[model samples]
Target: MKARLMWIAGSLIVIALLGYGGLSYALRQNPHAVLDTVDRIAGPSGSVEQVAEASTGPHRQQRLLVYRSDDAAEALPVLVFFHGGSWAHGDPQHYGFVARSFAEEGFVVVLGGYRLGDEGRYPAMLEDTAAVVGWVHANIAKYGGDPERIFLGGHSAGAYNVAQVALERHWLEEEGVPESALRGVIGLAGPYDFYPYDSASTKAAFGSAGAGAESQPVNHARAGAPPMLLVHGEADTLVKPRNSRALAKALNEAGGRADTLFLPEGDHNAPLLSLANPWRRDPLVHDRILAFMREAAKVSVPVQPQTP
Candidate 1:
């Protein structure tokens, strides 16, 4: 009987090892699908609930999900992270691992889906970003999150969306939401200065929408903007590391609090991968983001009481 039990334990260990090897090999080629499967197999690290219905038409992100652990006794900081698919693809449902990871770390994490594809277009993407921010500020407390302690972040095209929505006042204004609601912003391997619309994804998302206009986030740097942590990989060729440097430089020149973290040999997906479980090759990226969020959360945005 003891020998049989030992055999069973040994078999389990070998299976776990094989699964790990297969997952690591597949992650290089298909990160999103692998993450989605991981979430499915292990289940989310915390409780997850859908808070809104998906919008009809190009508004993929009209719907969103919230993740939280059950032991919270007080309001925690909020983190709203969007996925990147060149503004043309990606679903937040597939990225539950991201939401759950931060949720486990004591944040009421929000993973929102935004509109994608040509039908969604340029302004529509930014518009959904504003809507999601507005929604979080207005209704996060019911889920044990402090609305004032809101941190916005994303990867790739999703990073572009949050940067523009936080930097450009007009989008939030159009939604009747105050920009001060945002405490800090985080972007990973984002494109802030790709102006020519040369890439297929950019051309499809913004070509006819407004190709020649100054829609780049680097163009909107100004004083009094929320604190920003722009993280990138020095070896990133997809969006170019210079995009992050240029925007950070612009923000610094404008007297805003903008800092950067560039991995010497990092690639485009490396920053995001650091936030994942069992595969975090770059923990500094994750640690730096948490530090920024904790510091920024202490300073509340001043807002006047609403008049009756």
Candidate 2:
């Protein structure tokens, strides 16, 4: 009996180690490749039009991909999404699955590419984001998007960029755009309050900016900022959920409208990856996003279930 109990315990230990190893390996894989695989499996659900030369960056000109519903005719709400890759990787191409999911739900989605970590840092990413937003504002009407109902969102590092651009005001001000132009901002598993450059990636991206607080979105939270929807998964181990909680708290204290959605079962990547077909589960991330946009834009469009 003692021998049998020992074997069982040993087997359980091995299984746990193997599971941990697999998850670690998955998390370490190239984010771009991971997103590409997801996109391929899910496939695009909307029509894609590429703006090969939408905005110019310090290194090279960037492109913007617009996702529009096949039957979209009238001006629709716009969602400009920024992809997260630790501020170093990821592209709009890898996010077609997400963009299309939004497009299918009656939104004209814009995915913009920006300079990454080694390519650029801090304000450069912010600059590119602002330029992209300006480009969308100026050109989205051609794609049947209402400029007045433009919303911005992103996951992880991208979310930080979105929050910075929307709240800091200077980035948009430099682009000759007003804060009021944005209807709302959304952040998913964003590191809005991470500071002191604990990680190499964070240091590489934001270390040079003296007084790290300036780079933190929580530091900039105040009244009159666009309404924000901050979402986080309770189980996220990458970026802590407290980042969202802290930012939301600050926003509310300042009399700003910042709503938070805490997913009891969500993880760091769940908010983004759950958009994929077959991988999608109940309480779809896309639905919550659309609902937030509808309420903020005050547009009463019926939500259409995404076809898997």
Candidate 3:
């Protein structure tokens, strides 16, 4: 009886905290464990499988987590996501909520993690992103995904990671992944035009690359690039909304399809936080992304998830 009462009390505490929007702080303090617990408490989302490495090469060293709804289609559309931690601190294991949210929505979600901090410098991170795409292009079919219907997405620095891969052809070409394979790209609160790095996270990850156009995704925007959705918050002082605005402007001017969204009340973390189940306040972000992916991929409609 005592243990049962304690269990009830603990559950109530968690419920209260989540109800009151304490998840953001919980994620900041311990993202991996928090999301893991959230995933479990949320009940069965889908089946998840992890690959140790995408490939055997040095650049192919990143890990991937694949999530599929219990009733996913034979060839479900794929969404590969990378987390944000100033490009220094993040792990694939931390985004189960993200994976579950999309997987539950009837998509095959891939949560990817690359090397971080000093070891993950500029080109290394880009290389890993491309490598992960290449691996998914080659192997996702075996995991019940359509290799041709791949969409790339990320938050913050991870957003830059996907943006670079989608905008720049060389990275994917080097990995034998044709740029056309990507159905669309989504970047939330990404820094695309920042050249003169001032933040410690930017400096730590990009210092070696120098303040050159070569490392900026905005510079790579051109005609024939894959469709993109860049969402940022006007209130975001961390990365700034101009990055997305500039990139979208450049892409559209160059004859590419890039959409931009700026939320007035949104901060740096709002876009990402909206992806979690509990804090999913606004439906526009999810709706727009889904519409972009569906339209770009030309899917007839959303596939209904089967019972797990």
Highest lDDT, which number?
A: 3
Clashing pairs in 2: 88-117
Give the per-residue lDDT digits (tens) of candidate 1, residues 235-257.
99998989988888888888786
Stretches > 4 Å off in candidate 3? 1-15, 18-25, 32-36, 39-61, 299-308
lDDT of 3 at 301: 31
Candidate 1, position 299, lDDT: 72
- lDDT score, candidate 1: 0.77
- lDDT tens digits by residue: candidate 2, 112-215: 77888665587778888888898887888888889878899999988998999999988888877766668888899999998888887788888865436888
Cα lDDT for residue 171, candidate 1: 81
Using TM-score as the yardstick, the better of models 2 and 3 is 3
Listed in order, each prediction's TM-score against the native is 0.84, 0.82, 0.85
Error of 3 at 253 (Å): 0.8
Q: What are the lDDT figures for the candidates, one per model?
A: 0.77, 0.77, 0.77
lDDT at 264, model 1 = 87
The predicted structure with the larger TM-score, 1 or 3, is 3
Sliding window of 10 residues with minimal summed lDDT for model 1: 299-308
